[model samples]
Target: MSNLTTLLALADSRLPTGGHVHSGGIEEAVTSGLVVDLASLRAFLVRRIRTTGLVCASLAVAVHRGALSASAGESGDLETDARTPSPAARQASRAQGRGLVRLGRRIWSDEDWDALGPTPHLAVAAGVVGRAGRLADQHTALSVVYTTMTGSATAAQRLLALDPGDVAALTFDLSALCEQTAAEAAKDVTDLSDPLLDVLAQRHVERDRPLFAS
Candidate 1:
């Protein structure tokens, strides 16, 4: 809430970091004709947010609460199980995690750097730090969700000729979806569980390099 600068820096696409590189399988989807237009792109992003992003946000809360300890073995195993449906998406999630953690140590680490590692998944790692920053769970969830959408959209714009205004409005409109997804993810049950995303992620890994790392 108070440290908007920190949040923005973490979420910004222009941070010299490589957030713009990976498309979370959007590139592959687009290349494979799974996503072709503004409407399709918007729908893809929403569904991704609701499924993958939702699970990530939920994992963040779970990690923050100590309800789900993210030791390398535990986190990896959990992510693996969650990712059995889509290995590529899972790889993308971890790629973002590595990128975010590397950035986190540079920007956020001080005395609390100890809690920075361990998490192999980006969302859980981000939640740990966000919670440490005293950020609300919902706010933390939104930050992660928006960051992901921004990254994917940035990737899309670079690869296509869509209207920037349309993308901007889409991002704004999708914020509502982020809220709903985050809210659902915060629930006590399997708030983050999504079948379609899991499958897509696994399928993403099966394909060779077309576009998008994840």
Candidate 2:
């Protein structure tokens, strides 16, 4: 497949990576009344994209650029853990990572799959997949950042019965910010943290009947 096609396939929400089930803390945000309408949702997404999103994209870029590996010690996974303060968020990331690793191993041949262990962080897995797919660092970063935004936005749409058109427009309007974040992420690894997201992730785990995993 072409490079663009490969990137699209990896970024597709229907990739069976278990990404659809996780809201990236949006469910908890909604329950907590932090995000109610389109305006609030946009604010939430902007904060997310600037913080965890940048961190994820940067880690993926580091892996894709050969600056980091998926190994346990001194690897991208540890960095991911350090950047992610909540245990629930870490678990969710590993769950998605396992799915990505499973799919990636079936589709691509790479020794990094074995090195990634049974449960790598999502960003580390994404980087390995990007490298194996021969994708550019920028493409990899963009893919990570895009998914980071879309996953939560999708969950909010479902939870609030939001107009799909408005949701689509909201994401489209933020495309430039996503691109800018991805560009910066591709340049270096980041340790940005979002305490509210971390708290929300933990709270989501405690919800009696949560819609999303995290």
Candidate 3:
């Protein structure tokens, strides 16, 4: 919790970088009738929080952990990130990721900031700050989980006709999964592979979407 204030503030929906425009497939999923109720949303979000959050946490630690490097963990994390099945999902990630890093540089302390041009991906931004904040595996994991969950929930406010209270409740539920995924990522990874996510992401490039630009 070393940089809790920064983490919470930047992650807040109010900060706004077009995050509301995307739903992480919740819009498409619900529109496609794949998700409709809180129960379904919960299930969808759980799988999402677990897989996506774990990837974010794993990559954050991997890219920055140095001596405690997690190359194997990164391979697994990248596997899922690359496995996103829908074009919208992949574009949504890259689009929001760009916004995350772009905004991060404008507001975050530049002293430690990398002049690496753009963030390239959201995980990079999360990892950079996660390392600075002294967040362990669990905390780091939850941050990314909540980030994606909240972003999707925010979009869901309109996408699913969900109430504000329900959104908050769903976010709370997602918190646990983030922690769980983080714990898994914290452990040594025996093997790493993820193709489904990548395939979906590649397809996302072909789809025509208004919200997220892949």
Candidate 4:
């Protein structure tokens, strides 16, 4: 397949990675009343892109930079896991990683998924898939950032019944920011953390009536 085709497939929400079920923490944020409208949702997304979004993009770039060996790949996964302080966040990452790897194996039959070991982080899975599919590091990073934004945006619309056009506009405003963040992430894999997001994930997991698995 061509690079564009591969990227489109990977970015498709229909890829069945269980990404749709999780709101990227938006559900928890809504439950906590942190995001009740377009303005708050935009703020949440911007913070997310700068923190975990950038971190995930960096890890994906690291993988594309030739950390393909078993040990090196595991190191990359560990690095991402360390930045995620919440147990719920780790579980969600691993779940998405497993889903992506499962789909990736079917697409790129030659690559060895076993080397990534059990419960690879989502960033590691994206990197492996991106490398195998010949996607550029920029595209990989942007896709991660894009999904990070869209997942929560979609969730907010559902949870708050916000205007779809307004939600879309909010995401549109972040295009340049996402590009800039992706470029910076490609340059260095910083250990950035969002404590509030971690706390939200922990709370989400402990809820008796959780809306999302994250």
Candidate 5:
């Protein structure tokens, strides 16, 4: 496959990485009435991208660059755990991380995923897999950030019955921002926090019938 196709496939929602089960807190945001319309959704997306998205991008770049590694024991998993104040968010991340490792082992055969430990962060998995595939660090970061934005938007679509076209268009419009954020984050993974998202994640996990894991 072509280099572009390879990257695209890695970022594809159909890749079976278990991304569909988590909404990046969108379901909880909607249930709490914090995101009701396109305007509010966009606002929430912006906040998320600036905070959680940036951190994920940084982690992806670090793993891809080998600055952090499962084998080296500097996986940055603890940092992600610390940044993610919510236990539910951490669990969701590890679940996705495990899924990525499973898929990566099948695709790349030689990579030592076990070094990353029993459960690395999702962005860390992306970095490891992306590096093994010889993908660019910026692109790896972009993929991570893009998923953060798109996953929530797709969840909102399902929960609110919003216009799919409009939701997709919104994602398209945010592409440039995602790119910029990824670029900056690749330069340095800034430590940031989003208390509201943490609160929502905690609340979502406590729900009797939560739609998304976090």
Candidate 6:
């Protein structure tokens, strides 16, 4: 398959990465009334892309570029752990990372996979997968940024029973921002934090019967 095809496959929500069960903190946002309608959802997505999205994309790019390696003990996983303040968010990320690593191992035969340890962070796993797949740094960054928005948007749509057409349009409208953020991320790793997101993630874990993991 072509690189584009592989990238698309990796970005697919149906990739069996256990991604469907997590709402990227949107569940808590909705429960807290921080995001109710299309307008608020858009704002939430925008903020997410600027904060966690950028950090994730940059980490992926850095890993893809060989600037950080799990084997060399310069793992981006540590950085990811430090940047992610919420234990819930960290657990969610590692769960997804394990899924990605499982799929990646089945597809590629590389020793680098062992370097990732048992549970790499999602961004670190993404970078390793991108490198193993021979995808461009920009492509890896774009994938990270794109998923950062789409995953939460999808959860919001289901939770709110939102019009799919409206949600699709919203994602389409944010494509430019995704591209710009990816481009910036490909240039360098970034450190950004969102305290509200952290709080929501923590709160989500405490919910009696949460719809999503985080």
Local distance difference test, each candidate: 0.67, 0.91, 0.57, 0.83, 0.85, 0.90
Off by over 4 Å in 6: none
Itemize residue pairs with steric clashes in candidate 4. none
Ranking by lDDT: 2, 6, 5, 4, 1, 3
Candidate 1, RMSD to the unseen true structure: 2.9
The lDDT leader among the candidates is: 2
Tens-place lDDT digits, model 3, residues 141-176: 556667777766766566667888987887876676
Clashes of 5: 0
Candidate 2 segments exceeding 4 Å error: none
lDDT (Cα) of model 5 = 0.85
**Model 4 TM:** 0.94
Off by over 4 Å in 3: 67-91, 111-115, 133-137, 188-214
lDDT by residue for model 6 (1-214), tens:
6899988998788888787888998999999999999999999999999999999889989888989875524668888888899998999988988888899988887646887888788999999889888899999999899999999999999999999999999999999999999999998889888999999999999999998878
For each predicted model, how many residue pairs clash, with residues at least 3 apart or on different chains? 6, 1, 9, 0, 0, 1
- All candidates' TM-scores? 0.82, 0.97, 0.73, 0.94, 0.96, 0.97
Better of 2 and 4 by lDDT: 2
| Poorest 10 consecutive residues by lDDT, candidate 5 | 69-78
User: Per-prediction RMSD in angstroms?
Assistant: 2.9, 1.0, 4.5, 1.7, 1.3, 1.2
Worst-scoring 10-residue span by lDDT in model 4: 65-74
* Model 2 residue 72 lDDT score: 61
75-145, model 5: which lDDT tens digit per residue? Answer: 47766777787898888888998888899999888998888887788978988888988888888888889
Report the CA-based lDDT of candidate 2 relative to the real structure. 0.91
Lowest summed lDDT across 10 adjacent residues in model 3 is found at: 67-76
Worst 10 residues of 2 by lDDT: 66-75
